[model samples]
Target chain A: MAAKYELKLGAATREAFGKALVELGKENENVVVCDADLSKSTFTHLFGKEFPERFFSCGIAEANMVSIGAGLASSGKIAFVASFSAFVLNKGFEQLRVNVAYSGIPLKVVGTHSGISIGEDGPSQMSVEDLSLACSLAGFTVISPADEPSMFALVKQAAYHPGPVFIRAGRVKVPVIYGPDQKFVIGKGIQLTEGTDITLISTGLMVAECLRAAEMLEAEGLSVRVIDLHTVKPLDRELIGKAAAETGCIVVAEEHLVDSGLGVRVAQVVAETSPCVMEFHGVNDTYAESGLPEEVLVKYKMTGADVAVTARRAYGRKK
Target chain B: MTRTSDLSELQSIARTVRRDIIEMIGTAKSGHPGGSLSAVEILVTLYFDVMKHDPANPTWALRDRFILSKGHAAPVLYSVLAETGYTPKDQLNTLRRIGSIYQGHPDRRFIPALEASTGSLGVGLSLGLGMAEAARLDKSPSRTYVVLGDGEIQEGQIWEAAMYGGFHKVDNIVAILDNNRLQLDGWVKDIMGIEPLAEKWTAFGWHVIEVDGHDIVALQAAFAEAEATKGKPSILIAHTVKGKGVSFMENNPKYHGVAPTKEEVELALKEIG
Candidate 1:
C-alpha cells in the first residue's frame, strides 16, 4: 500500500484551464475567451488580463455567452466560454444544444465548480447534473481532466478539436499525478496501474483518489487496475471492454451523480461487450449541504476508502 | 447595394414574394401566415436591395448574414431564399412536408443558405451577435441582420443578447424588430406590455430607428442608416400590421399560425396582384 509515485501539490483544474488559455492565446491568435460575469471566479480573468482584446465579459448572460461562443466558432475563431457549472449547463443548456451541439461548432464550454466540491456554495451552485446534460447532446466531446497536467493538455486539444467540447472542472486543488511531459488524446483512458482482479475507473479529482485506493488494495494482496477515464462521453469503450473481460468486474468513481455520469457510460460499454458486475461510487441520488470539500466527500461517501469499498463489493459479486 | 431606383422593381419583387408566401403556407395547411406576410418588406429589402450577398456563393466570407430570429415566419424567409436562388422556387410547395428540405422552421441542415438554424425564439440575436463579433475579429466587412418578433423579445434571453451587443458595440449587427403588434395569443401589448420599446433599445446601447415595416423605400433607407451609424448596434423597430397585405388577415392575431384556406389563398393572391 506504500506510495508508488511521489504526488505533488497541484492547482485546481480551473486554474490550469486559465493558464492554458493564456498559453494558447499566445500561440494562436484565434483563441478567444468569453465569460458570463464570472471571469474572476472561473479564472478566465487571467486570459483577459493577458489578452484584453481577445476576451469578452458577456455580463451575467450564460445563454448569450454560449451562442456567442458558437458564433465565434462558426466564423473562424475558437471561442472558449466559462461559467459556474450550474449556470452554464443548466441555464444555457438549450443554447448549448441548438447553437453549439446541433450546429456542430467547436466551442469550448468550461464549467468550473462542478459537483459538491465548491464548499459552502450549497446545492444551487453545485453542478451535479452537468455531465448528464452535456452527454445527452449528440456529437459533444465531454472530458473531465484528472489533474492540472491533463487539464492543460486537454484545453489545448479542445481548441483544435472540430466539434463541441464540454469540460468539467473542479474547485478543490488535489494531488498531481502526471508530469509536465505527459501527453493525452481525446476519448482515451490512461491506465495508471495494471492488474487483473478488478478495474477501478475514475475521472476528474476521483482519479487521484483511485490511485490511493489502488495502493490500499494492492497491499491487501488484491490485483487492482486503475484507469483515468477523463473522457466520459466518447469513453474509451475498447479499454473498458477489455477491463470487463479481463477483470470480470469493474468499479466506477466520479464526483458527479451516479445515475448518468461515468458509471452509466461504463455500464453501457460492459453490457455491450463483456457483461460483468459493477459498483458505482458517487453522490447517491441526493443533494449535499454546504460544507468543506473533505467533509462533503466524507458525508457523500466519495473518498478513496469509499472507492476501495465499492471495488471490494464488485470483487465479491464477481462469479 | 443594388438599390433599384425603379421602386416598382422592388415593389414587384415584394408582391411576388408575398404571393409565394401565401401559396406556400396554403399548400402546407399548417404554418404561420400573418407573421410571414408582415415581414415581407423587411426580408425583401434585405435580400434584394440592402444586404450584400452572392447567391452563387452563399458562404462567401464577406457576405452579409441574415438570421430569421422570428422563426415561425419561415414562409417569408423561404420565399426570399427561393427568390434569391438559394433554394429552387419549385421547392416552395414542400413547406413542412416530410422528406422535403423545407421544414416549418429555417434549419441550416436542410437549407445551406440559412445563416443560422432558429426556431426557438430569442436565441438568434445572440447568434447574430456572435457572428458580428467574429466578423470584427476577422476584419471581414460583413454585417449580420437579425429579425426578431415582438413577443419573442419577452423571452429574457433577448435582453441578455441586447445588453452584450450594446455593451460590446457590435456595430456589424443590426436587429430588426418585426413590431407587428400581434402574437399567437393576442396583441403583444395585451399579453405582455413592451411599451417604450425604442427607449429600451437606446438604453441597451443601441441606435434605435423607427420605420414602417411595409414600406420598401423606408426599410432600405433605415438599413442604409444602420450600416452608416457606427460605434453601436442598430435596431429598426419596424412598425407593421399582422397579416399585412391581405384584407381578411391584416392585424388579425387569429391568422398568426393558421394557414390560409384555398379560397382565401386565391383571394389573397388576387389582392396582391
Candidate 2:
C-alpha cells in the first residue's frame, strides 16, 4: 500500500471553485456572483469574465455585500458572495448571521484562502475559525470539500441548497484524489476505506491526509476505515453512527483547530448518542506561523502519518 | 385636531399600535418603547397606505420588501404586523420570551414579512440595495425599503453601503433614516452626531429629501417622490423627535430604551387620545 496511485486530482480550492462557477453560470442565468473586491484573489474573476452583468464587485465592503445578498435572495435568485475567508466571515459575520441565516436566504458565501495555508500572507488573511462561525448559525450549511471533483460537486449542490451556506477553501495546491466522475452528496460521507479496527473521520483538506495515513497504516497491518465528510454542518450522522458501531473507535481530524471543527461535530454525535473511543487530530488552540502548507501541517502534526499514529491510539482505546 | 375618518382611522390604528407596544412590552417585561412609539406613524403609513403587503400571504415573492434596520424598534413593526393579521394578536405577549418567534430582534425565520433579520445597525441599506439590484436584474417591479436609525448610520458599514448604492445606481432602493437623534446612552449629538445629514446623503449621490417625519402628508409626498425619481437611489431623512406624541417621553433621551411602567402606559395612551 505504498502511496497507491498517487491520487492525481490537482487544483487549489479557489481554482476549483472558479472553474465550477464558470460551469454553473453557463447553465443558470439566475446564479449571480458578488464580491467585496478581492475578485482576482477569490477567483471570482472567472465568473466576472463570463457573466459581467451577473457578477457584482462591491469593493472591500463585506457587510454591504452580505446584506445585498440577502436582498437578492428574497427575489428568488441564487446569490453567491465571494471574499477572503477572514474578512467575509469575521468582519461581516453579524450581517451573515442575521440577514442570510436568520432570513433563510439562498446565499452562498465562498471563503477563499481558508486556514493558515495562505502562507506568508500573515494571520490577518487566515480564517482558521470560519468553520466554527459558520456552524454556529442554525440553518447555515458549512461545506469544506476536498479536491477538485468534490469542490465542483459541492458548489453545484450549494446552488440548489435552500438557505445560506459557507464554503471554505484553501489557497494551497494539493494532489487531486478523486476521479472526475465521483459524485459528492451533502450530509453524506464517502467511505474511502473500510476497516474493523478504527474509523478515521476527516474532511476538507484533511481528507487527502487521512487517505495517505490509511495507506501508510495498512503497511503496518492496520486496516483503518476512512470517511470523507464533505459537509460539516448537517453532518452525516447515520454514517458516523454506523462507523462508530462497527469500528468501536474513531479518530477525528481537520485542518481547523480542535474546537468547533468537524472533530467537535463528530465527537458530539458519538458522545451524546453513540458511545465510542475518539481521538481528535487538529491544531490545538494556537496561532499558526508563516510556513509552507506541508511544513506548517507537519509542524502541527496533521499529516497522514500523524493521523495514522492517532488512529492506532484510538484503536487501542476500543473494547 | 380636525381630521377625516381615513386620517382618524390611521391615527386610531397608530394609537392601537402604541397601546399594543406598551401592553406587549409590559407583558414581556422588557422592550424598547421610545423608538417604537416614534416609528408608529411611519409604520402605519407603510402598512396601511403605502407598502403592498398582504398579511395573509406573507411569502409573496413579488411583494415589496421592508427591513426594520433599527430592529430595537421591533415593537412597532410587530404590533402593526399582528393587528394586520400577520400573526395572532395574542402572540404579541410572547415578545422576547423563550421559544417565541417575536424575539428582541425581528428574526425573519419567525416573521415572514420581515425581509431581513436585523438588529445590527447599518446593514438594512445594503440588503435593500442588493434586493434593488436583483430586481433590476430580474426586471421585477417590487421595491425594497429599509428603515435606518440616525444613530445607526455612524457605523462605518452603513457608509460603505451608502457609497455602494450611490456607485451602483441602485434606483429602486429607498433608505429611510429615523432621525430621532437619541441612541442607547444619550442624545446622539452628545454621543456622536450625524448633522448636515441631507448634504451628506446628497454628496453620496442619493436623491435626498428631508421631511417632517410626523407629518403624514409630508411622509406621503417624500415616499411618492422617491418612487418617481430614477437612476439614483433615494434617502428620506425624516427629522423626528426622540419620542413622538407621548409628552413625557418626547425629547427625553432616558426613554430611548425604557419599557413603560403601567402608570406610564396609561399616560401615553391618554396623550395619544
Candidate 3:
C-alpha cells in the first residue's frame, strides 16, 4: 500500500477543540464557555484564560452546565459546555433534552475523552453510547470529527450554526487526515480516497484506521473508497447511498458500540437508499479493560487490521 | 414600595388570575390546579407590577426575564400572560388541547415570549443564572427571576445552580420558592423533607427573604430588597397554601394534578370573586 497523503501526528481532537474555542472567543465577543471542573482535561481552560468573564466554571455539575448553556444561548450568546462524554452526555441527558433540544436553543456541547480511547480510565469513564444518546435528541446536530484540522474547522462551523450541536472529541492524538486548506460543511461527508471495489465509512478516531484498512485492501489488488462521515445526526444519506451503489460493499467503523453507533445509521441509509452487503467494525457489545489505547483498540477489534478483516468479509459476500 | 391603592389593584389582578387558572384547568379536564392556584399572586406580582416588559415587544432584549421552573403550574403563567396582554384572553380556553399555543406545559416553541420551555423540575434556576450572567456580560440591568417549587428543589440540579449563583455573586437573579407545602403524592416533608430551608440557602451564600406568597405588598418589598442587595443572589421563601382560594381544594393533594369539575369551577370562581 502506497500512502497518498502525508500523514503527520497532530494534537488530540480535544486540544484542537481548545485552540478552536480560543479562536472563536477572539473572533466573536458573544462566545461564552461553560466547563464542569474538567476544564484542564477538556482544554476549555484555554478559552477561559483568554476570556475570563465569558468563561463559566460550573464546578463538577454537568447537568447545571448544560441548562446554563441553554440559558446563555436563549439570551443571545454563542454558548458552549464541555466535559467527559460519559459525564456530560449521561449525567446531563435530561437537561440536554428539556432545556436545549426541546427549548430549541443553539447551545454547543463538546464531549471530550469520548469512546474507549481515554485509556486507563476504565469503562466507567468511557462513553460507548454517547453518539446514540446525542443523535436520539431532536434538533441536535451531532458531529464526530476524525482529526485536529477537521475538528478545528467543524467546531467553528458549529458555532455559526443556528441550532443545538453536539460534538464528540477524543483524548488521544490521531493522524492528520485533512490539511488546513480543506473546507468542511455540516451534514456532508468528506471522501478521502476514490475506489470501486468497496467503501470504508467511519467517523471520529476510526476514520484514520479506515484509511489504513483501505491501504491494506488496495495492496491486495482491491480498490477501496474512504469517507469521513463527521455529522452523524443529519446523516449524509446521499453520499452514503452513492458509496453503497458504487462500491457494492460497505464497512462502517467507529470506536463505539456496534449495536447503536454510526454503523446502525449507515445500515439504515443502505437499507432505504441502496441495499448492499455490509459489515460493522466496533466494540461488539462489550466494554474494554484498562490498557494502552492501541492495546485496548486491538483487543476490542477496532484497529485497521481488524477493519480490514471485516471489510474483506463484506467484500467476499458482495456479488 | 407598593401603595395601598396599587396593592388593591394587584390583589384584584391576583383574584382574576386565580379564577382564570381554575377555569382553564376545569375546561382542559386534566391539568395541575393546586400548584397553579398556589402561584397566582407570585406571577401576578411579577407580570403586573414588578417586571419591566412590553407585551407587544415580547422579545425585547432589555426586558426582565421570568422562568417557571415548577412548570406544571403553566395555567397560572398563561393566565398571567393573558392578564398582562402577552396573549389573547380568549386563547386561554384552548389550553392542553392539540394545535393550541397554550400547551399543557410551558413550551416556548408555541409561544416565543417564554424565556424557556420548562416542565421538568430543577433546571430553571440554572437557566436563570445563565441569563443573569449574560446580562452581566452585556452590562444590561435586565434582571432574571425564577420560581421554584418546594418539592422541585429535591432535584440535585437546583442545588448545583444554587451553589453557582451564590458563589459567583449573581446579584441580578432572584429565585422564589412557592412553599405551597404540598406535592402530587402527598406532603413534601412526608415524601422527602427539605427543612431548615432558609439556613440551607444562607449556607449556599444567598440572601434569604421569607414572605407571604399571597401578599402583594410584601412580595413587592422583597423583590425590591433583592434588587438593592449587592454581591449575592436572593431567594424568597414564600409561604402559600396549595390551593388558596377554594375551600375544598385548599391543602388538598388530590387537586395537585386533577382538574376541578365544571360545577366545582363555578363554585371556585365564586369563591375567588
Candidate 4:
C-alpha cells in the first residue's frame, strides 16, 4: 500500500482515544472507564464526561484502579482502564497480570505518556519498557496505536474483543494517518510502503518517525518498506514472514528497551519462522535523563534519522 | 417472617462441601487443600444462606459480587459452585487438567461467575471495593463481598485496599478475612504476624466483627451486623483452623497445597462421615 500523508495540523494520537471513546459510548452503554487520577492526561476523562455513571475514579491508586476494572468486567461490563504507562503497566503490573490478564476480564488498558516521549517530566514519569511488561502476559494483546484513526479503530475493536488488551498511546500528539474509514484488525500489520531494500517495522510513536524516515530514504534512492505494527502480541506473523522472505532484512523501532520490547517479540517469531538480519532501535537499557520529548528521543536514538540509519544498516546486512 | 432454620441441614452441607474440597483436590492430585477447607464455612454460608446471587444465571448484572482473593483455594469455590448448581458436580473432577476451563488459578474467561483472576493476594478486596462503589453509584442495592486469606492480608496492598474502602465509605463492600493463621510458607504468625487484628480493622474505619469462622450461627450474626453498620465498610475477621475438618491436615501447613493421596482422601472422607 502506498503511504498516504495524514493531515496533522492539530490532531494527535491521545485525542483520538477520547474521540473514539465518545463514539464507543454512543454505541454501548456498558462501555465504562476507570482512571487513576490521570483521566485528562490519558484522555479517558472523555469517557467519564459522556458516561458519568459508568466512570470510576480511583484517585491515584493505580493498583486499586485495576482491581476496580476487573470488578466491573466481572459484572459483564466493558471497562477501559486508563492511566500513565509507568503506573498502569508498571506499578499496576501485578494487578494487570493476576487480576485482569489471568482472569481474562474484558478490561482494555489504555496507558499514555509511555517511553522517553514523556520527556522533561523526567525518568520516573516515563515508561521505557511498558511494552515489555505487558507483552509478557500470555493472553494479553499489546498495541501501540501510531496515529489518531488507528487508535479509534482499535478502541472499538477492544470493546468488542474478548480478553485483556493494552492500548499504548503517547502524550505527544502524533500525525493523523488514516481517515475515519480506515480498516484495522488485531494481529494484522498495515503496509505503508513497498521496497526490496529493507523492511522497517515500527510501533507506537516510532511508526510516524519511521514513516518520515522512509520518505527520506526514498529521496536517497533507497527503497524502504515501512510497516505500522500497532498490535505487538499476536504480532502479524504472516506479514512479518512475508517481509522477511521478500525484503530479507528488517529494522525494528520502538520506544521501549531493546532487551524485551516489540523488537524481541519480532525476534522470537522471525527466528522460528524465517531468519533475517534485524537491527533494533529503542531505548538502550538505560533510563532517560530530564529533557524535552524531542531531545530525549534523539538522545535515546529513536528519532527518524536514527531509524533511517538503522534501515540502511539492515539493508547493508542483506548480502 | 422467619428465615428457615436450616441449621442442621446447613451444618451437614458444610461438612459435605469440606469433603468435596478434599476429594476433588486429592483426585486431581493438586490444589491448596488447607486454605480450601478453611474457607468452607464462609463459602457454605454465602452459597447456601447469604449473598444474593442467582446460581442459575451467574451473569446477572445486578447480582451481588464476590471475589476469592486467595485463589489458591479454588477447590472450595469449585465445590461450592457445584453445590449451588453453577456447574455440574461432575465438572469438579476436571480441575487443574490441561484444556479444562479450570486452571490452577481462577480465570474469568473460563468462569463468568469469577470476578478476577486471583492467586496473587490482597487484590480481591480492591476489586470488591470497585464493585461495591459501582453499586453505590448506580443505586443498585447490590453489595460486594471479598474474601482475603489470613496470610494474604500480610501484603501491603491489603492495607491500601482497607484504607481506600473506608475513605470512600464503601458501605456495600464487605471485606471477609479468613483468619486461618497458616500460609503457604508456615504459620502466618511465624512468617509475619498480623497482630491487633480487630483494632486494625477499627483503625481503618471499618465496622469490625470478630467471630468463630467454623460456627455457622456466628457467621450469620456477623453478616447481619455488617449490613446494619452505617457510614463505614465492614470486615468479619473469621477465626478458623487452617485445615478444619480433615484430622491429619488440621492446622498443618504441610497440606496448604499438597494434594492428599488416594489413601489420605479415603481417610479424610471416612473421618468426615
Q: Which residue ranges in model 1 land beyond 4 Å of their true spot?
A: A1-3, B1-5
Better of 1 and 2 by DockQ: 1
On DockQ, the candidate that comes out on top is 3
User: After aligning candidate 1 to the native by TM-score, how far in Å is the CA of B35 from where it should be?
Assistant: 0.5
Q: Write down the DockQ of candidate 3.
A: 0.91
Kindly list the per-residue Cα lDDT of model 1 for residues A215-297, writing each as its tens digit. 88988989988889889889998999999999998999998889979899899999999999899888888778899888988
Fnat, 2 decimals, each candidate: 0.71, 0.91, 0.91, 0.67
lDDT by residue for model 2 (B98-189), tens: 98989998887777667778887778888888888888898878888888998999999889888988988888888888988888988888
How many angstroms is residue A18 displaced in model 1 relative to the true structure, after the best TM-score fit? 0.8
What candidate 3 gets wrong by more than 4 Å, as runs, is B1-5
Q: Candidate 1 i-RMS (Å)?
A: 0.8
DockQ of 2: 0.75
Clash pairs (backbone) in predicted model 1: none
Candidate 1's residue-wise lDDT over B121-195, tens digit each? 889999999899989988899999999999999999999999998888899999999999999999888999897
> Per-prediction DockQ, in order?
0.79, 0.75, 0.91, 0.55
Native-to-model Cα distance after best TM-score fit, residue A188 in candidate 4, in Å: 3.0
Q: Which digits, one per residue and each the tens of the lDDT, describe model 2 over residues A274-312?
A: 788999998889868788767777887878889988888
Better of 3 and 4 by TM-score: 3
